[model samples]
Structure formats: C-alpha cells, structure tokens
Target: MVERDRLIAALEDATHASSIHNSQPWRFRLVEGGVAVHLDPTVTPRTVDPVGRWALASIGAVVANLELALTSRTGRAVVTEITLGDSIPEAADLAGGAAYGEGPLAVITLGEAAETTTAMTAARLHGAIKERHTTRGPLLGGPPTEEEWAELQAAVAWAPGIQATPASEPLVRSLLSLTARAEDARQEDEDYLEEIQNWVENEAPSGTGIPRGAIGAPDAEGHVPIRDFTQTPMGSSGDGEAVFFEDPPALLVLHAASDTPVDQLRAGYAMQRAMLEATALGLGIGVLGQALEEPDSRAAVDGAAEESFGAPVVVHQILRLGHPAGTITYAATPRRPVTDLILD
Candidate 1:
C-alpha cells in the first residue's frame, strides 16, 4: 500500500514531462515490483515526427520525471531497471532500435540506500517540473555566464550516455540555416502544416495539445530557428506582426553516444534534467528540433557537434536558452490526467 502511494504520486509528477506536440504518447502499467513505462504504438505523429525520435525521447523524459519524483517525494534512492546495460548494447541487441519502442523502456522500483546525492539533486529538480514552461517565443536577454553555463551543463551529467555542447555563433548560424530549411519545407507541406496546427490550440484549458497561448509568432526578422506554429494551413505567416528574436540564439546540442532507441531516450533523460535546471536558474527554453527531424539537417547537426566536441556522437536534441522577453510563466501545456494515461 505504501509503495502504491509513492508510485501514484510519482506518476502524477512524471506526466508533466515534455512530449512532441504534447502527444502524451506514453502509458504506464502497475507491475508487481514497479511501474512500467510503455510507448503507445499508435500515438506517434506520422507527419511531423515520422522517425519517432521525439517519441523515444518523450518516453525518456517521463523516465527522468519518475526518477526525480520518486527520490524527491520519498527522499530516498530508487532503482530504475532499463534495457541499457554496462555500455551501449550491440546493433543486434538494438535490432534497429524499433524492437523496444513498443515495450517498457524502464521499470522504476524502490531501492535500499538513501543516497543523499541523488536525493538532493532530485529534490531541487523535481520541484522545477511544475514550474517548467517550454518558452516558444523570443528570449530577450543575453547568454549565461561561465559559472551559470557550467551549472547548466552539469545537469546532463546524471548519466554518462549524453553530453551537452554549447553552440558557437558560427555553428549556431549554420545549424539554424539548416533548421530554417527544414522549417520552410514543413511550411510548404499543407498536410504537415495542418497536422502541427491541430496540436496548436488557440484557446486555453487545453487538456492534451499545444495551447494557443503556448504558440508564439515567428521571429519578425526571421533570425531564430523556432518552429512557426503561427503559420496558417493556407501557406501564410501569422498576424502580419512579428518580433525580433535574439540572434546567434543561445543554443545547446545534446549528443548521445550512439543512434539507438536507448541512446535517444538517454539524451532525452539528460535534456529534461537540463531543462529543469534552466527553469531553476530563471532561464527560458526553446527547442530547435526542426533541425534534427530532417535528414540533411540532422547530418549537419551531427557533424558540426562532433567537430565542436571532438567526438563521435549522435545529435539527438538542441535547445535554445536565454531570459524570456516576457513572463517566464506561460500557460501550462495540455496533459492527460495521470489516471487516464495509465494502462489497464
């Protein structure tokens, strides 16, 4: 009964984690020992997220919330049983990575020791979960200081499978150009435009989709590489009004050790932690995910990040970070109730 209560509370907090389009593609089942995280096969967005990269990452974010919430709520260490092993599993083990997408990515169970280290970290971050709002608009202020940057970078060290590389101005330009190309292509596709807009709710009280309040206008100067939800289905930009987005946009790329389903989840795990940390630091966060969703742009991201970091890596996620132009507290995004998200 005690375990059931902990799982219930943690699951509630975990549902607040990020997902593409607020798709809420994950489901949970109460197993004998712990709660099981499952990816609902039908929920993957065929047009926008054709490759399911964000789906895997979305599951990973949920895993992160569960880990933090379990430790934060109970103030104790928890054991997470995942498919990952001592190291990156072989290709045969990954089996093109799709093999595991339909099953539980992880099982969260109670553990013995009260490790103060993770407990403290969890307490700090878990509190920020509710405070996090994916800022889609322009961030006004400048970048982080060396100290702040280091602290923000440290959040990803929760696991060894992922590394965070801050983008230089030149690198940022190149990456954004690639991202803009993809965004342009998406804009041209009426089907994709319709699909994305469906997720963008112009009204609030959104139960499980991107609310209208959450959607911001494209950069007036077309400088930032943000996805233009403001685009209409008839192939036009929104409102004839735009704002100047911060240029050389503060960017951070998350690199995973390999391109596997497990690695994608690992990158997301770290991404969520860093996002929570950024929120704690009073930073606004945006995603340059369009760059990662296209093939050519994806390769450029991988090559540029590898050159920047001097290592072989898979580019999984990119974040644009800075102080918000407006309120840091935007409206809450849509999310299904925890009770509704659980599997029978």
Candidate 2:
C-alpha cells in the first residue's frame, strides 16, 4: 500500500513543476491509492490560455514531478492516465463554477513496479527536480554536444503521444519572427493585458505568482522575443544591455499527433521530462509559448513541425535550450505551498 506520508511528500515536490507565467494552476486530491491532478479553473490564465492548453501542460509537468518523486522513494514506476472533460461533482469543483471546458486534465495512478527498478530509473534524474528552473536570461554557449542531445532525445521517447524535433537555424529564425508578431498582437489587446497583469505581482505574498525578479532582461536584437512581463514596472528586473542571440540557439518544437486536451497533457509530460533531462545535462532551458499560443502563430508552428518531422502534427510547446551566459545566477521562481494546493 502507498503510504500517505510518502505520497504527500511526493505531491509537495510535484508542486515545484513549471507552469505558464508561473500561474501554477493545479489542485491535488489523495485518491484511493494514488492522486488526482485537477486544473484549478479559478486560477487558470483565461486570457492567455482560454483553451487550457498551457494549463493542462502545466498539470502534466506536475504529474511528471510527482511520478519521479514517488519512484525515487518507492522504486516503483507511476502510471498516469489522462481523461478530458470528465465531470466532477459540483461541490468538488474547486473553481466554484462549471469546470473549465474540459473538466479534470488528468488522473495519475501509482503503478506497481519493484522498488529496485524504480530506484534505478530515478537515480540519475532525481537531482534534476530541484536543479531545474525555467531560465529566461540570455543563453550563451553554442549547442548541446551530440551525446547531450541524444540523452535529451531518450528522456522523452517514452511519452506516448508527443514528438520533439530540433528546429534548424533557418526554421528558428522564422519562428522568432512569428513569435514577435504574435506577441505584438497580444500587446494590442487590452483585455489580454489586464488578465496577464493579475499574475505579474512584484510583491505577491502568496509566493505562487511570477515575481519581478524572475523576468529576465529582454533581448531586443535576439531572434526570439521573451514575454515582457515588466511593461508595468511591477518590480521586474531592470532592462540590461540588449543581448543578441548571434548563433542559433538550440531550439526544439514539441508537437502532438492531434490537438486535444489529452494530447496537450501528454505534450506537457514530454516537455517537463525533456527540460529535466536538459538540466541533468547542464543545459539551461526557456520556453517560447508565444509561438504556439495564438491561432495564427500556432498554425505556423504546426506547418513547421509537419515539415521538420514529415508528418501532420499539432505544435504545442517551443523550447529554447543552451548554456546560461557565464556564471550568471538564476533565481528560482516562487511556488504556492503544498498545503494550499491540496484539495480536501
């Protein structure tokens, strides 16, 4: 039987998983033998993620961390089954309203595996949980060594419905242009600005939202445009000298066979696993969600993915990978306490 205390500890670690804008939109319930991960609709970034793609992906990252934590402890692999639009009792909807268009994002069950097997599986990756952070600062260095790239490729191969394709230099340049256009479009929408502002609290006491310090200096001349969360001066890190991404940064386009909530969840699982694997390989990682957030941009990315993989797939996430410039330090983003995330 899974010990409740052990499960709680794993859940706590899972809370450290990455999310869109650090929204951290997830709730957990200790089920019969495992845990159910739900999207906290009230906290969901409706403006930026109206379809809940990013939110579902964030939930998958949490599941990845939870499973990793459990296996590290029990030496047993965890099983995750994602169900979309599964209805929940009115009383149980933490958002206090109809659940988001698609009800719960996923229900992860702890599966049976020998402790030794699980331990062996998690031994190499266990340290990445704490070490991994979404790097928004300027990325230096050339690219991942052949072996490093191979390890990253191997990490997400087990995720069933996701595909990762490295973007070529020409493709990366095109994506950077598309991302700028998408971000400019979002900037013109006042309502979208208002919604995003709510999560950019410079002095957020709850320790769950994006802090100003976490926003890296924007790279104006760089190929990709990092989201400017500091437009309002919410104590965001002051803009520094414009850094240029002269060499093509290591980029990966993550896509799914189909564009569905469940597929998005699987994409999230693959993304987090790849990020952690990159961390283990001493690579800094950042996400370019703008490229896949809006309709036009998303379609463009889909075209890029289809061309790169020679298959029809829906792009879900774009990752920027490379080594951090010099010894520049990156502060960890804040997360809500595990106590606050648990649903009774």
Which candidate number maximizes TM-score?
Answer: 1
lDDT leader: 1
lDDT by residue for model 1 (1-344), tens: 33677788999999999987777777899887568898874555657765667877888888888888978877667777775432443443232233345567788876665677777888888999989878877888877667767877898877567878788887788788888888888888887887776667433123677766777777878898678787768655466467788877888888877776677777888889889999988898999889787677788888877777777778888889998766655876767778887888
TM-score, per-candidate, Cα-based: 0.90, 0.89
For residue 235, what is the lDDT in candidate 2?
A: 34
Error of 2 at 48 (Å): 1.2
lDDT of 2 at 9: 84
The segments of candidate 1 whose C-alpha lies over 4 angstroms from its true place after superposition are 1-3, 84-101, 201-206
Candidate 1 least-lDDT 10 residues: 89-98
Q: 178, model 2: CA deviation in Å?
A: 0.7
lDDT of 1 at 123: 88
Supply every candidate's count of residue pairs whose N, Cα or C atoms clash at under 3 angstroms. 1, 0
Q: Model 2, poorest ten-residue lDDT window?
A: 89-98
Candidate 1 TM-score versus the reference: 0.90
Candidate 2: the clashing residue pairs are none
Candidate 2: residue 274 Cα off by (Å): 0.5
